[model samples]
Target chain A: MSAAGRTVRPVSIASFAQSQNVRKDNERNEAEGLQPVIAEVFANVGITKDDVDFICSGSTDYLIGGPFSFVMALDAVGVWPPRAESHVEMDGAWALYEAWVLFQEGEIDAALVYAFGRSSLGDLNEILTLQLDPYYEAPLWPDIVSLNALQARAMIDAGKATEADFAAIASRSRRDALSNPKAQVRHDVAPDVLLEDDYVVAPLRRHALPPITDGAAAIVLAAGDKALQWSERPVWITGFDHRMETHSLGARDLTVSPSTAKAAEVAGVADGNVDIAEIHAPFAHQELIIAEALGLDDSVAVNPSGGPLAANPLMSAGLIRIGEAASRIRAGQADRAVAHATSGPCLQQNLVCVLEGA
Target chain B: MAERCAVIGVGQTHHKAKREDVSIAGLVREAAKMALADADLTWSDIDAVVIGKAPDMFEGNMMPEIYLAPALGAVGKPMFRVHTAGSVGGSTAIVAAHLISSGIHKRVLTVAYEKQSDSDAMWALSVPQPFAAPLLAGAGGYFAPHIRAYMRRSGAPDHIGRMVAVKDRKNAMRNPYAHLHLADIDMKMVEESMMLWDPLRYLEACPSSDGAAAMVLAAEDAVSGHYPPAWVHGMAMRSEPTMFAGRDQINPQAGRDCSADVYAQAGVTDPRAQFDCAEVYVPFSWYEPMWLENLGFCGQGDGWKLTEAGATAFDGDIPWNASGGVLSSNPIGASGMLRFLEVAMQVRGQAGEHQVDGAKLALGQAYGGGSQFFSMWVVGSAKP
Candidate 1:
């Protein structure tokens, strides 16, 4: 604990909504794509924009090839009377953290958090390359898959895992996706079949990669009394924290996630037994790494909503993990869960949010 | 209620058109180190970091905070990045305050910066959208027409903008850190400058500068009297749909709402009488008068009177931008935080040459994205 977390106010997820994950969505623009999901999320909770004291979003200009993409996405909510709103360049999970911070301030009763990514709009691989170290790494244009492969290779060299371990994780994640209605890539595949898949980079295989998804998601959060009033079964967020590592790939121990472990500890993820966890690992091998960082035993079910392997929507995928974990608690499927979000190359930055059912 | 938060220290890099002397990481570290030094703290003492900037395209790096974390000594520490257009700088500070005020962190470090020389801001902002109207002109071009409308509606004289240009440039002469210190600057020079966007002469507009602004925020209990802290009385942000009918771009409702929200929390019933000074974003000279009206410093359509009457100068009653505001130095992303940092400087009695004498209260505001986004804060010398 940072000493300041002692007096943290309790917050809860009142509602969650998402657009169907898809490989292409040429039919709608970013705002248009987000409109229905925003309305549905608010409607699902029986609350409107007026109920939200603040609004925060996560998105990137690279997705749309322009700056201030969230500016346009606000139209979906009809931000009238100039509501309090902000946007993050990272993931919606971060935006949720901002909202959570404000909610803890005890001024605002509730907040709206949303994120949208049109990965299909441009070259996802090329756009992501821009996130690299411009001077030393981006010039090389090592795509994200290759970077993940390097991490996987490091993991393999450390005798921590193998290519088969990555395949088994992917096979299980996709098999679980069969029940998720919004999943973009859902199918029953044997681990043996996945092991035969061709390598996209070196140690990374096609089955280990997440589908390129264009999707949007939203989460409505309420604080204190508002939480009790908004939803019949609000999933209380008991602990939340995010930690970042160094930027240089060579500077860090690629096989270990000290950042995720620190975030999980700060978030109090291990205070009680985790019933389930929705981890945001865009790549399968990374999931094993983060799960270890969280110190979750096999007894704790992971990614009940298929996780990012089912429908990885860049900016929204991380937020969806929180929603997925919360939804399980809301539905009485689980009592305690930890939702994780990762960013940067090889999951250098991570967020862990511990949720509980009352 | 939220815990009281205060600005214990503030620091800013010298604004310049191109800071080739330092890399982007070095540029921000300069401000961060200075802020830490001012606060008598170290990297290990800070609990977290919250950074904000405009578009990543400005530096051609996506979410540069990932790389900046090491420079800020944020590894193994909670870190957040805020990007809300130009208002990001102000909002970044607000988010940091929340970390303290919400009892999440006792000490938080926040920063905003822009290395415009790394990439052409004009081209970065003007990137074409597939389904929307092309932004033919950069920010100035988009805002020039709004400036024209304010002139037509307020019936303000053309010289109002020129006078503002002269006054701000003159103020820059006193600010050693200001990018444009035109010692010989005058209305004639402003008038003779090329009209980049009609009604917005080159001299009347903000220069593209590279700079960073950083601040150390602490919970009131942590302020052990090591340094004067600017108590954050209130902080707020508001954003509206970027494009819509009946949107008053001249005096945006977001700006009005943002100021009203912050002022109300800070108990500022009358802005002109309540605050000792302000640091407002005025990229183009014309925005000075427009924001004066929007911020409730004066009645609608009467803002030009303030600028025209020399009421907004360093020697004026409610002196604004005494450290030479965005009009003199604009590191696009850091411009908003400079407004915030300058206000803190004023209230802390540290704004060297341009300090508002015996300043008790101060206000800072920033707006961005076609005037649809707004962030503002009120600071005071005394503990709130």
Candidate 2:
């Protein structure tokens, strides 16, 4: 509340679309994989690229194994004479955040934000190890799954969660995934049966881990009169913020995600009654952690779209949550929803987006 | 109208081939700390942090700002990361400045860094992609043909590129933070250097280095704590696809449009006469002249003549790269910001050994990707 009287403009998600999540998309290049999705989003919104004032994208070169991967992906949008474009090498959710901030500038009326990832080229776990401290943690070569397992184990040892609780989350997620056509993993299973699955890492079973996914997602954001003209019901972003934690796992408390808590607080998660919460927790146990950190009640419908456990497309998954939550609002299924996106190991960084029906 | 913004402080590390003494976080912190100290503030004084870098693969880290946020003292605060290839550094600074100009934050810390020593950038640039030609060679190989096209179109002599190399490397000797201090570097040394890409010699190319650049930007009301604020006169960013049917990769329209927009905002009818100095991205020596024309400092096809006339020399009418520029040290992500920071340093009179005398108005420019992305800004000693 630096400026109490500042008017908070309503930023809405006008339309959203995404590509099918697949393990390997060898047939389609990066731009080709993203073109149809962008086309679908624009068609749904009844607008073209020319209508948008700003264009932002989220992507990573590590996934493509090259530099300027996002720059090449711009070909899908066909920027001929150049445009006001910017890129973030993070999840698409953060790109939306940047777009949201640009909207606050009041100069730009609308923005198009998108993200893409191809996890099929290399070993996802092995590649994520590079995100650690190069001189210290990376030299040890601990993969992402093993690191998450450490956090899960610490939570279990501290009596914050249990193996049965992890199975229950996986069961509910798979059950919810059955209704999602875009979900990669969608099969209803009993929690008791899921408890029989072998452990990928101690205290974390195979069911708790997210599948390797490749996909792309796009969202169009419009403000003021443009938002009203684009949709009958606009999913307005009321509060949005993101925070980060230390890179060293040992330096942070493994049992709790301070970054997520801080982001949720800053995003005004406690201000209103949220009917649905979409948390980008790739691991089953991490969902419980995020749920607790956000202070959500049991009455709040969590992950109705199956969340990341079903279709975790690295860079695009976070943005997909915001899209999904906004879809619920647009459909009049919920008055308010909270979408969360996390980056780095064990949620070293987190972004929270609070959307409401208008 | 937007709120007024100014560069309150700037900091940069000594660029080198290998900064093995510090980790990536430590390297960025060195510059961030110096910027904070120069601004006469602490980490808590800043409201947010924006980081930019060329590619995560350059440091073997994907979305490094996640891990780097806390080290830069951005925990519990809003943080954003920007990546637009080589122009990322400049774009990062612009993004930070915009936060203030948009009246969102009073004080913002913008940082950009690249640890090329951690991973081989050549390998990162050569990753094979389906449907694309096997351009297995590094960045130099990709741009060499473009340089040849510039030479053919402009009809510039071959000696022009060598002269730029000698001039920038010599300027590097004056800046202690410059990575390559070739005290005896000359035309003879450049001519004998290895030819990595045809028409581009090794000495003509920028050296891979590990370094970081940081700047503390503040709104007009927040500038009272600092002296000699480099007022931001104008800023512009433009980007087009890397490849298209008839796009000019040699002299990108994006760069020209970006410069034109910035110049218009800064009220510069003539860049050559109005601006006291300039800092343009020149990873390859020949780019200095090419950018001189693209930035509207001179007419198109007449840029190389400026180099030949010695107008771009350190002691010339419009001195370019007085702080050695990217030709001497390129941390990829930080190189573009270094250009912007050097421009601010000149205007603030903070550039100790490399300070240009009586520099009032200055221009900073950065272009990246296949030269399709461009970001530029105009700053002056007086508030606009």
Candidate 3:
């Protein structure tokens, strides 16, 4: 009867697809932007929208300057005859979580998860400020850069990381992104050379910032036999969990991500040797914080798709991490991996998914 | 089903036009705290929290759940935000129930709210988009034509809308949580009221109120011993494209499919006979009959016959909105959850004066996004 003793239904990622990460694309609207990715993800798995029992999407309305923005995006999936559907305001990663939960119910056999964002359509930083505490923080209109700088300063003051460490992460990420064609920003700068760039904030250089991106991504999840039928190599989600810390920045220590640590523990992230990890850390220094919390070692290659720092689409960035990690396992590049997604300022809420090529 | 889930606690704030007394976090916490106390559980006993709201624009707050996680005691716990337009409240609770029904979490807290007074809902709904037509009529303006179409399709009398308004408004008098309590309400007053949208009088429309609703859902083994728990017999959510050539705006196919799925799971052959009382989302007066047909309580084009014959009144064979409904307290986001919470209350025999006598089963429903999104559930006193 105990929840901890209960076993979750085995679910696997069958197919993944994403739009080319870009600064802006004015020709296409949200639904138009998603139709190709949605169709390709299904076709890649030898199925169509009819094969999916449920559909879930992720997006924020503020980015589109309208409410119910996700409603229009539903058209991309061609849902008809009434299909079970839901949406999350956070990220496409959370939509995947919702779809996974439905799959676990054992009634639904498969689900389609997708996310789209046009960060270039609006003032990205100003719009993000609306995500802060409305009564206390939102009125201040503090941009995301300033808030992340405060977290970076806190990390430096705690002796957990420095500006050089931040530059090193950025240097490796962009360099790795050079191999990623879908990536928006790819370069070959050394850590020392990257550190020479002028600071966007006091402690963060231009390399520390993620490029504003407009993109869409979709993935299909199948249960048990359906998983094996859909793909030659299915990346099974062994464990999954997400946790949130207090909203107040002052309430947290800021040097470490306890929520990520808790989520990792619940998700059984350290159960076996990890071959590759894709962590959604938009800020350079935050990567160090999440990596430490997840207890990843140097042996684990992080952000081979260059992570969020390479191509950060507001809502799609997080799900892209899961897709990147799953694609590696599917392509016979890795046996085991962990994908992480963060929401709120300074990683206030964190989700961890442990996947294996079983 | 993966596992069994039940509704152990149901709580709602006193819905009103404006709740300036509490901050957004404080308002939701009020309902969450009550739900916890009702379940005889503390914040620590809850495993995860799921929150939903219509849109961030309703309160000028984006992703409010991230900031609300602390107030809902979600620190170091999984917290989810569900946004499905008007049906978000019901969808939020369904997501929380699925967490337990899937054997992932034991005790989950679900809450939904809208502080309409904090920001203008009309302005948010009518915001100018670059290449799209604005919903200039707002919600009522968009739906009034649908109501007119329903009347045209069914030949329903004009008195049906007025009858529903009087029944629900008077029913609000017995429920303290309802936002509206019209003591002198009557058919004459309703028919004479200001007509906002043609065929939809001011009295027939739902009020823009600020409120929140919460529920504590538990797995089979974690049910509270103090109070009778309402077992979640079945739940379903459905969505279709907002606009299409063959779409039926009057009785949406999504709502029909959603209700049929839930009813089939609950072994309901005839909803009119199976459910003792119902809490349907009736934001506009005509929606009462529109949804009665959509939910399959009666055949299409015949839903008004039930209303015309007083079959949906509190004393009728199949009572609807016994505790009033969205028409009484229209907190844009929480309206759906309120319908969900009321069914739980009715099934548990906890609804006070407005309670239906010997009510053992109930139907809860919500629809949103131009009637394209639907969330519905069945709750029973006996275990499924």
TM-score of each: 0.98, 0.97, 0.99
Please rank every candidate by TM-score, starting with the best: 3, 1, 2
Error of 2 at A59 (Å): 1.3
Q: Candidate 3: where is the Cα deviation over 4 Å?
A: A1-3
Expressed as tens digits, the lDDT of each residue in A8-99 for candidate 1 is 57889999999999999999999999999999999987889998998999998888888888888999999987899989898999999999
By DockQ, the best candidate is 3
Looking at model 2, residue B314 earns an lDDT score of: 89
Top model number, lDDT: 3
Candidate 1's residue-wise lDDT over B244-291, tens digit each? 897988988888888888988999999999899999999999999999
Per-residue CA lDDT of candidate 3, range B145-192, in tens?
999999999999899999999999999999999999999999999999
- Residue A212 lDDT, candidate 2, scale 0-100: 88
Tell me the tens digit of each residue's lDDT in model 3 across A78-118. Answer: 77888999999989999999998877778788999999999
Higher-TM-score candidate of 1 and 2: 1
Question: Which ranges of candidate 2 are over 4 A from the true structure?
Answer: A1-6, B224-226
Q: Write the per-residue lDDT of candidate 2 for residues B323-368, one digit (tens) a residue.
A: 8889899999999999999999999988888888999999999988
Winner of 1 and 3 under DockQ:
3
What's model 3's overall lDDT?
A: 0.92
For each candidate, what's the DockQ? Answer: 0.84, 0.65, 0.87
